[model samples]
Target: MANKSVFATMAGKLLPRTDTRNHEGAQAYSLSPRQALAQLAATGTFNATFYAGAREQLTEVLELAWQVEPEFLAKTAVFAFERGYMKDMPALLLAVLSCLHGDEFGRAFPRIVRNGRMLRNFVQVMRSGATGRKSLGTRPKRFVQAWLEQASDVEIMRAAVGNEPSLADVIKMVHPKPTSAARAALYGYLIGKPHDVLALPELVKAFEAFKRDPSLPVPAVPFQMLTALPLTREHWVAIAETAGWQMLRQNLNSFARNGVFEVEGFAERLARRLRNPDEIRRARVFPYQLMVAFTTADAAVPKVVKEALQDAMDVALANVPAIDGRIVVCPDVSGSMSSPVTGHRQSATSKVRCIDVAALVAAAFLRANRTARVLPFEQAVVEIDLNPRDAVMTNAARLAAIGGGGTNCSAPLERLAQEQAKVDLVVFVSDNQSWVDATAHAHQGTATMQAWNKVKLSNPQAKLVCIDIQPTTTTQAKGQADILNVGGFSDQVFEVIATMARAETGADHWVEQIEAITV
Candidate 1:
């Protein structure tokens, strides 16, 4: 007679965001995540065709998750399986089920056992769902049993894994970064990294840096940064001895269980003095502290390209004046950057649009007094600052010298993280064509969501801007530009980057950033 339903207790408990668009999502090939889920539920009621590509499915899944509940996920988990939503999920969900209840917990994560009790909550989500009128998949059942009985290292790896290392340790890995300075301070304890972000780039750099030079630069940046306010030395970042950012950090346990990565090293925290980040005050430091640092090293790229990069910087500086704004931009001759900058598909010949734009933006930041570091990635980063003069041949030589081949997607983003507090934002303009994921059987990387997820985890405080100018040229035009994969792919890129940027700064900052790029 009443609504004593399992859905009621945990309707919106796990994930809180909800996608409300219902009509437009169906009319178009794409649906906002929430509509997809709603459609999935509605689709299950009737017989319907859902997309099959893993990347597309993943986008739909994350968008749904961003807005739906575990109850909704559970329903889709059950219903979508029947509808051929994506044939590969049962195995993944089984691993999740096992990881939540498996004994592998104490062994792989000994320190976590004391507080990782959150792992148990996952089972309630699995068992309470409607597996009604259906037989449990065997591999999934067996996996769950194996997990409940004896969770082994091999068992965990079988679930999902890869080697991912990071360069720094202090930055938080949470998404939707809060704007409050007080929250930022309290977040140090709560906003700490999950086992994954540590395995990203910053951890690698920080460790290698320590090995080479044990002394960490005290203030992070080269010189100084203006104090926002209430960021006094006496302030403590650790608040709510229990109720802090760890509220979610504790959930990172789920990551080890379901995500495709590992944390197989001495688990440790980066020790540093933290102040109340929630507050900012004027005159936190002298006016001179705002100046940014810039430099480019490595002689592999064409020297003229470096010159051109500098010339662009000069032009950008001439346009704006900001004290601490700086950029260290390097043009690449290493191979990947020289492909072509034209925004067309068939024109695979050489061109100079991205390099030119990269140089212009890099120089503009530096001229504004912000530090900019630019390099092109192939086997590794070729840090040759493209030297630009008024001469066209010089520009062409630099552009022609630079080459674009191979894939180096993560390197630049990691580079930005290495700069730490020194950089306030990162604007990466590139063509979204990675040999690694773009050619995968089914755009599997997009489905995994790790690469996208990693960006949110590692650079918890920096603004990341991706302007896709994927160009094409047959021969007539030097290069043409088309912004593709703003969401990573066309749809996902728009959703993912915008979400991460807003999370890094505030919604307001994200607005200003878009205006800067478009205006």
Candidate 2:
């Protein structure tokens, strides 16, 4: 009976010793080059996080991209853009490929740089000289030219929204040979050069006519193009009626401010549009995005519209699997989790933080599986009763309110061990900067690993999923058959969690998922 804890053997493979320090200076395991690249591709926005700066993130991603094979880099770019729905990191990877691997860059270009914003991001990042070369390089220039040439006139007009490297700037740099008189005219118009106005596309003509005479019917152009123009509430009402799902969700406040909501029957129409399952599915709305809309809506925004956002949350959470057996979700509500989820960027910082995302994940699970247990952890487990029937936004708000403490990733698992609880799956949504439970010695894996070992003693089949909401190359728990380390705030993570919880993925699950991408 002497020191059973010291002498006991675990049923699982021995955890790897902590090999590196995380951004929080806690002992952690360094991810492999491929794993690190994929993790960063999924979560890194190259903005300042609580622990790392934008430059540091950019350096790390470039370093990791260099370490991995060109194929893996291509696959990761495809995975990040298509599955993770990430913007900047995927473009960065593709930019890196442009210099070193032309063929892989070509394969990934059309996929990652799929839209206008992404196209601008590619040009901007490539020109930043952060990816080792400043110029677009010959092949990448050809790809850009082809993209400009193939996109429809409306697509090009929509692409004209953002700047830094505007679509016009790209057209100037690439000088894509116009295929038709209309194409040449459109290019000249975007770049502010004189061209035959008669050759312009009909939509462009309509937009120009509407701009000149406000009495005409409002053209269906991007809202940015119309914002500066003097328009009546009637025009805004028309824009609100026709705005796409994402556009509408993002502009509720603008609609309210413009008195578009004052029109009779329009509010009800909008509420229905927001709650439509088909619209939500087609838009690929993330649950947190709905949370943003719900929280950011002004008082003038109609009540029905807010309620419809909640309904949209339920639809977005459709992928959150109702896994069988006991489950525990641990969301780190530490002080650092308060950093902007997308990292901090001046004038562009997200009101949503890492804690909010963790809470959203936990609440979504409880919504999907009524029996699921949620333990919000800071230095230790914060006890709170949550009604599964409550709206996902409500539960998420409650969890996020309990915040500003040290992170101890092991606390919930240790509590589960203390209670001798039998769990089928344990999900940890956090920044993974667990230092409160750090051990003094380097030989030990981590406090989280040690606690997970104890938990596994009673339930060997139990799975663990660590969803890192911030970008980092290390984890408190090393990934194995029973453990998965995935990153990103996109709802796609829920699908990965569901698949992993069912034991459907092999070792290096995250990397394997990236490899499966057909780039």
Candidate 3:
């Protein structure tokens, strides 16, 4: 009865949404309360409570998920209750606790473990009495993990991030001068995720703590910016730079047939014995250069409205200190990354739209160097040294390499890691699935594959950033998403890059103040 009331309370808070009317007794049903409420909702008893006896039984809501392995799912609960479920509860716990096999869940859990009291109890229980214990944390209940696992990545991220800690909240919690556990819990919470909403107040406290005392491992540079691709609209949807797709001054067939998209050797000829001015003029006429030039003009916008972007560019530039603080992005030529990344996917339209994001990030990097490289990567990395003097041959190699295959993150990560001079950061754009092994089959449900799989870190010290493009939720209307074969690319890339980026930009570093600039 009490649990039912609790559920009712939660429901009331959750209900009365902007849209649809609230479900009368729905929220209360979540609780495994006493028999009365169910009986009432059902057959209208307890007051003849029969939520189960109702026209539509109270248990109907659980039917869909339980339908997974109908006989097993349906019968198992009863068997567990009547027979020996709690005896095997740990195993069942693992079964239900899906995060052990989840991607972002596993990644965030250990950190959450340190913060949550219930999780701490669960972990302790697992250590003493469980057969299976996962590395991220403990498996106390199958349902707990499974329920958490069923939730998506962003959902988990939001949940893991608690209410943004504010100064007032801390003041309100009157500690009996504070216990050690409470203090550590509070301190860890503050440092766990700086700049995050729930954790921001804690972060601010930590910063004040650090400023007062200089030696407390002044937090590392947070490299989150480089890890996120700037070229794509999704990365920083506010950046108004028009990335791909020319407005059709000329027809595609006509342009391709004539010398439009052609890669001429004007730069080569200019370097050779040729009278290069005209050759440079011809190079200037090439599409890529025209596009790059277009992108830069947009990058120079003033801060106010585009403050975050300008700050990103400023931080990226300041950290790397580019020759002119600009990057020339010749993204992967493993395939037709030569096409504008934000355009249509009709082979011609969507050719390299994905690469556009990479280019933008790289451009930000180059703006630091005053110039950057836009190369192709497939079996190997080919420097796409585009000539500012001559533009025609620029897209030549990229055009030829348009049909790229086999992308190796190891190759790039290795190269970036090996570089003698430390650049501020690195960002790569590709459909990440390319890095996955075809043999990497899913051994269990989506859950199992995520938990146990771990790729060896190639660039141990370097921040290896990757933005794998997946078919957008609206892909059917937009067209086939990029066909890159890297399975678990997004998960893998985000995991590695976020950690590294966080390290690069110290926790003390202000996000907006870090030396990055974005237009």
Q: Which candidate has the highest TM-score of all?
A: 2
TM-scores for all candidates?
0.28, 0.96, 0.26
> Where does candidate 2 stray beyond 4 Å?
1-13
Q: Weakest 10 consecutive residues, lDDT, candidate 1?
A: 473-482
**By descending lDDT, how would the candidates be arranged?**
2, 1, 3
Model 2 lDDT per residue over 1-519, tens place: 768655566546676778899877889999999988888888988899998899999889999999989999999989888877888888898898888844898888998876788999999999999887889888999999988888987789899998899888999999999999999999999999999899999989999999889999889889899999998999999888889999999999999999998999999999999999999989978778889999999999999999999889988888889998899999999999999999888776889989999999999999999999999999989999999999889999999999988999999999999999999999999999999988866666799999999999899899999999989999998888889998888888888888988789844877988888887
Better of 1 and 3 by lDDT: 1
The C-alpha RMSD of each candidate to the native structure, in angstroms, is 25.5, 2.1, 26.2
Query: How does candidate 3 fare on TM-score?
Result: 0.26
Clashes of each: 89, 0, 84
lDDT-better candidate, 1 vs 2:
2
Tens digit of per-residue lDDT, candidate 3, span 88-188: 22222223333334342333233223322223333443443332443323332432344333433223223333232322222222111222343434434
CA-lDDT, candidates in order: 0.30, 0.90, 0.29
